[model samples]
Target: MSHLLDNLTVHPDCRHFRGDLPCRPNKTHGYVCESCPVYAPVTSRVLIIKLGAIGDVIRTTPLLRRLRQERPGCFITWLTHTPAILPQAEVDEILKFDFASALQLQARQFDVVINLDKEKEACALLNTISAKEKFGYALRPHDGVAWPQNQLAEHKFLTGLFDQVSQANTMPYVQEIFELCGFDFRGEEYVFDTHEDKGFNWNQLPSSGPRIGLNTGCGDRWTTRLWSDEKWISLITQLQQAGYSPVLLGGEAEDARNRVLHATTGAAYLGTFPLPQFINLMHQMDAIVTQVTMAMHISIALRKPTILMNNIFNSHEFDLYGRGQIVGPNRECVCFYRGTCQLGTSCMEDLPAEKVLQAVAATLPAATILR
Candidate 1:
């Protein structure tokens, strides 16, 4: 068996694995036995390719859970830019996207390759990988353009470009992605492994009424989705008046903006923490009001009731697990994916504070709502 070690892919970070070797290595350092620093041939392997929009990466992790369930102990490698967002227990190895990682992945053999991304770059990468079976979106013959790899993916794939098609499609995002991988979407919850050292002193927050989180930014990529600060201020004031503690949430880009919101509205500004601490912070919220941002996914993953503010994207695409409500403008969205709306009045601004407030109340647990 030792003689066969030389034939396996070697890595400096792994211990040699034996067929029956107790796998004594730190399981967190879950390198494949065949690909570990020391080598041994492993039977089955799976690779998942879904990159960008950290929120999408987090939500797609249900597939990881299903993958592990289908092939227990099989080596699973996930390729993503936001590795920290993934639960450590899901995949054995996480390959962050890059030239070196891409080369290494293309060299490996896998039983299944799942690429859920629609971007041309991810599509091209999927085309280069070797796998016995491929699912999800793949690169077409035309310059690495994206196309559905299987019939299951065709529904959402066809709707990807057209507004009416997407509006008409009722399949949830997770269900569609799962079907793409030849798996069933079984209302499987998002798995986010919490670290032991990720202890946040919950006492630091005010021991007040039901704490609600308000995620301020919609991200620069989709400026058309932004609700004005004035609206947020109004909502904050209303939350405060109604006895619900409002906490503002955002990344570093929103520091100054949050400070202004905090100063004017007196909403709690806990400031942004790293991914782990941020997760802990969100756990403290009873309910959350957010745009289609990473925080929304985190809120859903944590099982907190969420009020999703949507404008440009298809409402049918979201699967909130009956834990949330979608609040969009009263008018239909003409501009689909564009960052800025060319219309006279931004649809996001048209979304009345009362509508958002109503959604927030609806998602909150009956006990949490003061009224």
Candidate 2:
């Protein structure tokens, strides 16, 4: 038994190696670590700590492409609250935020640790992690609040705190994150796996016209971003009149309202789905119409042409990848980043349906235009 134990060897640095079980090559072809021809070793391990609000997670995927270019032989582990939305193939391991996962992470060490989220928990995790190099936010030792780890993160940190600085800032969210990690954002496209959904078939959707997905909710947290129901009905009617297929999209929060929109405008409403299936559903559309929500980020990641309705947030913060338009209200928004409308009425009310309709026609490919 001692002799046998002495002869055993393992390669933890191999990307295919699973610490708890047999590696893929060994399981599939009985390839031992000593003589495995397909062995791929990684030079370093990296951890990405982005916790929640799924939209930010989707947008953060662009950093993966940059990371790969800079460090071709690095293995990545992502700690996220919404692990289901992340591309498993792109990342070596996706960890959901729970007590067990936190304990597991605490025991392990990484070559590089990056935390883009400023949440107290995220900063605390960054502080606890053992890494050769650390970037982005960290928990301040005295106050127990989030603080920038380095100078690069200061710009993004300040922008979030001050409305004027955010409004005057020309850097898009992607560029800011890239700079935070000491890389230039050269229009690196989002890395998303569109083939994750296996259950749904979208054959029933109209085959003639270009499918337009109208993501109709801004979420409960941001009531200031909601558009009037009357405006959505008008836009759907106009799309049908122009020989376009209008489909409503949302999560459980927006389902009842979406059903109402479908009934009122005779538009297609293919109910809410899991995150992966929701991404797949968005992939079927040629273009999308949405406010500043998860759907907007998903649409951008899927590379669909989009017309983004805006009012509360800074328009400059969004990078549409030159494939979409950001249409703000005619009346300037008084509530910049506030959740509730300070003016008693949302500025989205001033954004007319005809304007959004024109944006839709302008955004889609010329061949898809029916009128």
Candidate 3:
């Protein structure tokens, strides 16, 4: 069975517990209490540390659910950076920290601590956590060499380690990571709660049939992932003619591109808002048209129809999210995994505007279409 399906089969049954059974970390033979003094039945408080971009944080939520399920009475605290986008429901306490403040906090001993960062500083922080059992990714040669030197990629590497230790090669996706850690994955959904009373101003949006959100800018300036501004403008015009309001959504970095697109085609440009507000705004839209970014993942979680304009290699990861239309070149574009497209032409530019418009039309609700 696939790791995903295998996870679904093993639902936690109350009847299985026979008067405080020994805690076995995994399917391996050794029992925790038998091996060491630190393994005694203690307060099962879990500390999960994953602080990074919006997309990576979203992927880590399922792990939280899994930890909560297996250790029912355990107190779960997540250490994330300020302005970190997350689903409010998953964490019991969100300890926001900066570099200086993080080093000073009292180190309360934890039963289990999981570090998902990939930088040297993160490693130092992991060592500081007063935990009996600590789980993190094993260091690899190719890992932790990014511009910011993230230690979090180490967590991804650790997934492979766990697989090897368990004598299994197939590791589950982000969802199954949490399931294997002991959480029920069946009914869990990605959620974002905006505590604001007024919520998003729908009136600011164009009053038309089927509004579609277009995210033009990614976090970085890698041209490989970006569709041409001209193509985006052309696509917006086509969608407008097709009786769909194409609202442009992007971060501050895309203000120039948004202006260019707006000037070319009078599309409604919704500049960057906070993550919660953006999610709230998305809840009102019919579908999302984006690249391989956090917005695409959010759309998938919301179950809103999405048309992803992605490179060939990264498309597989997005495919795992399920329920989306992927638009890219017919062939394996040479810029598949490269940070920046070295080839003179960007594959995203090769995707014609009409093709994307067709995808949007097909995915949007028929009731939302104007006659």
Writing each residue's lDDT as its tens digit, candidate 1 over 264-349 gives 98889978788888888888788989998888888888888889999888787788899879989988878787787888667888
Model 2: residues >4 Å from true position, as ranges? 1-5, 196-199, 365-371
Look at candidate 1 and give me any clashing residue pairs: 11-37
In model 3, the Cα lDDT at residue 184 comes to 42
- Which residue pairs show backbone clashes in model 2? none
Query: Best by TM-score, which number?
Result: 2
Q: Please state the error at residue 85 of candidate 1 in Å.
A: 1.2
What C-alpha lDDT, on a 0 to 100 scale, does residue 167 get in candidate 1?
76
**Stronger candidate by lDDT (1 vs 2):** 2
Candidate 2 has what TM-score?
Answer: 0.96
Ranking by lDDT: 2, 1, 3
In order, the Cα lDDT scores of the candidates are 0.80, 0.90, 0.64
Question: Residue by residue across 38-138, what tens digits does model 2's lDDT show?
Answer: 88999889999998889999999999998898999899999999998898889889999999988989899899999999999889989999999899999
**Top-lDDT candidate index:** 2
lDDT of 3 by residue, 1-371 (tens): 55764443332322122234533442244432324333323246787776766676666766755565677767677777733466555565577757644664334677877766655555556666677766663233355332211343333454434533323324334634443333444644554454345456767788767888898876674557877777887888888887888888887788889988887898987677776777778777788988877787777767778898877344434433445588886546776455676777777777889888878877775356552
Residue 335, candidate 1: C-alpha displacement in angstroms: 2.4
